[model samples]
Target: MPGSASPHVLLAGVDDATEAVLRTELGGRAAVRRLPSGEAVPPDAADEPTLLVVGADVPAPAGLVSALQTRTRHLAVIVVTGRAGADDTSALSLLAPAERLAYVRADDPDGLARAARSMLDRLALQHAYRTAQAAAQRRLLAGGEVARQPGEQLFGPLYHQVLIGAVAVDAAGRVIAWNRKAADILSLRNDAAGRSFPLLFPPHVRGDLREHLARAALVPSPPTLFERLGDDGAAQTLRMSAQAVTNPDGTTHTLVILEDITSSTETRRQLAERTSHALLSGDVAAAMTAGDPLRQRLQRSAQAVVDRLGVAVARIWTLDAQENTLVLQAAAGPHGHLDGGPSRIRVGDPGVGLIAAERKPHLTNAVTDDRYADDQDWIRREGMAAFAGYPLINDGELMGVMALFSRRPLPETAFESLAGIAGQIAVGISQDRLLDRLRATTEALQRPLLPPDLPTLPGLDIVARYRAQGDSLDIGGDFYDVFPLPDGQWALTLGDVCGKGPTAAAVTGLVRHTLWTAAQQDPDPAHVLPSVHRALLRENSPFCTLVYALLDPSDTPVRLRVTSAGHPAPLLRRRGGRTRLLEEHGPLLGAFRATGHPVQSTVLHPGDSLILYTDGFTEGSGAHLSREPEDLAALLASWTGPSDDRLADRLADLLFTDAVTRWAGRLRDDLALVAISAHP
Candidate 1:
């Protein structure tokens, strides 16, 4: 025998020479066993045979060839035939019924050796193919069974099929079940199912597993990808996804899927470290400039990260507090339109799919995968190939999300860098909110220091009002002053500085204090106007209008001397219900250095009223007036009652309420009103 392993040859003829030749070729390949022409084959030999050689020249019974062929069906059969046409053709027809059979010529020694080698090669290939197929079928069956079983019974077969070590442990760290794969890896074969997981794993990993398991048991939807230790002493990365599986009896169990992703975990850790370093290199301080410059810097930072990291698209979404939606703040990419065109996403909806709805990080490597089948339309519309979203949480609240998109699928490791970037964005948003609150507080504190109260004078009912223009951060420049002069007469003035806010407010204070002080020295309105004008001109300021007046109630005409410094004309309402615009005025203050312009005089009878106001009141394009002078005159003329609290209230309503309605609830300038009326 060629190999002496096992030789089972079926010899049809009793020729010694032919048998010896066949025996020589199969010597070591198999244990050469012979079969007679009329002898029945052993049943065991029929199922398992190393070799089978048949002689072609021997004639057999009618059913002999069919019977022998059936017996040796499982064995390899070789036919030794003559080179003649009839023998060759007949042997070929008989060979069709037998598998693992080859024909060789009787005179050919090389052909027999070649035939043996060929049959052996075919057997080896068939064995390998069967082995692989059997293994695959076993895995498939095991996986299907695990998938169908209750959660408590699923862990064992799943780990075995995946060839990954796994053990299901309860919250108390006791193992409920362990798979064969775990036994192979950990070298623990006996009683592993009921043992404590902590005894098998390291203390730290055991603690982590218990903590994660506890959380999963309590939460409605648990987090996945928890890290755990492997059987090997070295750190073996694991991803644990848990689902709450409830039985028919209402008993709940945590179905944990354990995946060994050591290489992927290490990649994520390294990438996160590199991303942190890269983000630290960004000029965060420089990016937080004021106004449009700040927006530009922020855009550039986002663009730089996208470019350096090879992200197909990057976007920043900010929370709109009023609208209660997340609006796209900035985005950059070739398909950046995904973030454009009403980029507001409702918090409760599945904006960009479930990622925004859950207010947590969502990652998908394949947009067309079964997990994203429900959101395929949205993904296709956005041209999304792969997506990752991380919530931008500030103070534990979801402010928005920072998302990255790619045309090609990215590994899970890519999201760690983006999550870190989202954290940074959250910090920035929190800081901005803090600054805005501080600014509002500062503005509120400054409001009390403005024009506090109007002074009270005998024989005159006076009303003063100051209102800030539309929700602006700046303080107003309007001021009203009432002080008693040395002559027992009251000097009153109302004026508006050219601008609004702190600078204008400062100028208003200066002009008000100067007028009060100048009026005390010279009770005449004309003299007070020139002194204040010269003081303002010395400061090299622009022109400001003022109406300064001295009122003496004891006099017959109520002795009023009024001076105008480029101010609106005062309205005079008589007791008979007649009103006129007092246009007698001088140049505005700060126009020249005390030009000696004379003061204009106007008399007020008892039961008459005088009104002084800034341009804000008359500038209103209301139905009452088309211009400042006309608005003032018409308002005064309409008052039928005595000028008392009711009249003052009416004046305030006309200026503020009526004008706001006319201007569509917006104010273009600060408004100030001062009303003085003679008592009956």
Candidate 2:
């Protein structure tokens, strides 16, 4: 039967009148059973009895106390004496264990019945506490989250297994309940149940605890750490965490937990010091090497850590940006194949599991432990009996992780060490990334400077363009200009410098400024070419190419005079759909020591056009025509009288779009175009 079904009583050593009085008082309240003497009580009777009433002063059998202690471990035993002195009470305390004993005056029937009823109530409570504690243990062992209620008793062997050092305090800071572990650590007994929690702690920690408790009560969540002293009088560090217990009526109580973390804290401190030294000395040495040497040095450092710390396996995993996955970098022990091999794990892959999901340290004591048996296959395959892993995070971002696995259970000290080392690794990775970013930024800033909008010219519609070579690291060394000379003539020039990137861009800038100065000094387009070419060759190499032209649209026939310096000849198109190349013969600029080069002149009617371009247009393996010079002539011959901007935009689209499609999105070089159109 259930312990709470009915109140049970075992009666002994009462006179007939007293027995009659007791039965009259408790007959309806209790289920009364009779025992003649302590010797005659049945062995199985202890299970059925809730209270045992014996004569307090009666001389019982020698083995009576021992027998009662054994059989009635769960039963409450009450002693009644006709008349007893203080010494008798003291003797009774020694005779019976406090957990099982209660004393009452036998002459007072009312007092005897009250004592028996109170003992039955306490026994029922203890039974319920054990039951609740058993249920909680099953839940915890099954890996389920279990919540507790305020003032609810927790008692059981299994409860102690999960909760090592547990204590409960109320809002007022009074100790409500403490388990065996807490009591042992605090050197407290049953009398400490209602004492203030502050009195149990050392003087220095008492005020801090009160403030923490008060803050915990005021906050919506909980506080994680609090301090206290140990029973051995040594300074102890305790972690006091609290959960708020709320009732349906909105009343609140705090369920505080005291965890002894003295050993764990000290272990963390020592591990941090060791990790700092290793990172400072070892990482620097490893970073000094190149390629395989660096990787080997890193692996050796990891191996040294495993040897010094007595760990079974250690591994490092790094993030791969190309694949967007984590790949094992280095490893030691039975799973050494993971080192420098591709073991890609996505952010939330099923096989990757909770280690990366939580972004914190994950620890498991045994592979077969009931709490994690559901993942047993993975655990065994990795040869991980005890596992601890921490993320390598820098600036609050996860870079990778360092993990240690053991075929045997790991001590708490090992967990602390691994966590500290993982943090140091994170710092090293952050530093490497920052340096790489700085280099990339410095390289990206060297592109050629180009004006957003070209200057407008009266009676002339001009379109100028510049493009960078796709294969080039920086910008191309191309330059173009369309400016009016001082003598009422429009002068234009296009040139290609020697190289690429910052050096080429610098040469282009120098040539551009020098030609503009030469044009201002001598208004003749023919004179400007030699002067600018001479200035460019002085500071630059002989590998340059240039072209200069002068257009006087005010003349009746619209005269055009042009000169070339190793540049592509200009192409001209007439209104009647005939095109020809204005191939003026001249030596390439900066090539030979030259004196005077002849100038070629031509006249254009209204509605005629000319196209000037860099080699990027004709250098493509596949152009509009198989022959590049013939292709340029054909493209100009087919031109409609479109606006300069419209024709330039369409030209760029046709050239780049066809090139991108044919090359599968690869552009081998830059292309520039300058179109000059005269309106009728």
Candidate 3:
């Protein structure tokens, strides 16, 4: 009724004056036109709507109504009568009975207009309803036949093809008659007359079924469910109802109907499980976006697995890079026996090792404990009947392991769910392990060689790693330090002294201490560095190459304002894998009485990487390292570990392990590396 278009209305047997009145009363919404007597509606307008307003005094009014209805059911007829014709029954008797019949008194001023508008409105509503019904049927059946209404012509021959089965049994529990649906569903002969009803029922429900039948004669009641063995020998749920009827001979008889609902019920159950699995997956995905600590995030995910999937002892194990063993990252369960157990499990089978070695998931029954006995004897003693283990592998590298155990076997749907959970665990474990290592390195870098271990600034994960190249007794002249400034920004420095030993070390210390003292007065590179340079000039400290950077991530693309003081240009890798060398260099620190270090500005998009290091990375001096910046950029491109995980490790390996080991001669200068990545 509120659609964009209104139905067409063709009015017949009306004078020009009356037609004008009808159109005005109808609000001019629909196309209202009057047709002359004995003239049929056009072919185009016939199927939409043609309202016939016939007067009882008109000639052959009944014939016109009959002809219009035969063309299409879209026609409706309203017969109006003057006061004289209202008393006559001849015209009414000639008309056929239909749902579209209406009557209005010709003497009434607006009766004909009201009837026409009302009839057209009804026609519009019927069209919309029929269209909606057709759309719903098309969606349900896809491409199947939906030309007519459901259960109309299509269901005429499908009485037996329906999923439900039916049969009739006498009061004595003897099957007297059965439909083909029953025979097909139960897998029996169509003419299974005089067969025993109780014999066909599954063994478990026969007793209750007999009791129901015994009570049927005494009580008039609703249908009761009975478990019956299907053709496949599995129990099927069937509803049975009984009624007692008197025969012509004055004897009483019972009629029973059987309907099966096992498949439909099972379908519902599986759908529920899948929906719950999707919800669990959504929660974990949400946690991935959250800023919670890795282990805490993993703990929440593990608990979700246990709660949604009904598994006991959900746990995550990460592969230790040094020992190559699976170490427990998080565990969730109420069982106390697992306390004080080996947090790091040795890499072997019957547990996590088998999942890794086989390169797939494994479902085992630990109760038997023969071929797959767990290394931990406690697991064997628990008698957990079901155990599911999935290897946490990413990009062909084994990151860790995730597993679950239960006292009872899980449903078939749960296995499908476990596969997806395992993949998520792999990503979680890899990312967390990588971040943990990076954080450890970062904290060591943050504290520097200051007053022992200082509490890192809270609420931000900014950390730095300084790796001095030497044994325990030997300390290198290369150094880096970070401290929080007054206005929520971070101040950091990475520098390399000219040479090693006492003079270089003293210069490094003096440079750092002078910078520290200057930082208190002013932490900006332009403000602080000039004072430190003047003091270093007075002290005549050894020359050191350095870069001072201010880190500010509160903008769309994280901003870094850096001033290069004769150090190597820091490399920035964009999120798309391209690299850039920020070449903004000035005189070495303490080289001039008053130095003007040109400030370089850059932004880091999410997932981008920035690395600052000593020249040792490029001029491998004695080693066969890549001396060209282009070669170094190519090497940086090769170390593509999971960006969110192990990116710092990859940077370390490229600048230290891989490049340093390939030196042409011998190592000379100390190396300092600082790497950071932007989060999405």
- Against the true structure, what is each candidate's TM-score? 0.39, 0.38, 0.41
Best candidate according to lDDT: 3
Tens digits of per-residue lDDT for model 2, 12-73: 66566666766776788677767665354465555444566766445662234445544444
Instruction: Please give, for residues 278-306, the per-residue lDDT of candidate 1 as tens digits.
Output: 76336443454434433464566567556
- Give the per-residue Cα lDDT of candidate 3 at 443: 46
For lDDT, candidate 1 versus 3, the one ahead is 3
Candidate 1 local Cα displacement, residue 553, angstroms: 4.0
**Candidate 1 global TM-score:** 0.39
The CA lDDT at 420 in model 3 is 78
For residues 424-497, what per-residue lDDT tens digits would candidate 3 score against the true structure?
Answer: 76777677666667656534543444334222432222334455443212446777777667777777778887
- Lowest-sum lDDT 10-residue window in model 1: 147-156
Candidate 2, residue 555: how far the Cα is off, in Å: 5.5
Native RMSD of candidate 3 (Å): 20.8
- List ranges where model 2 is wrong by over 4 Å: 1-449, 540-542, 553-559, 603-606, 621-626, 639-645, 648-666
- Residue pairs clashing, model 2: 56-80
lDDT of 1 at 288: 41
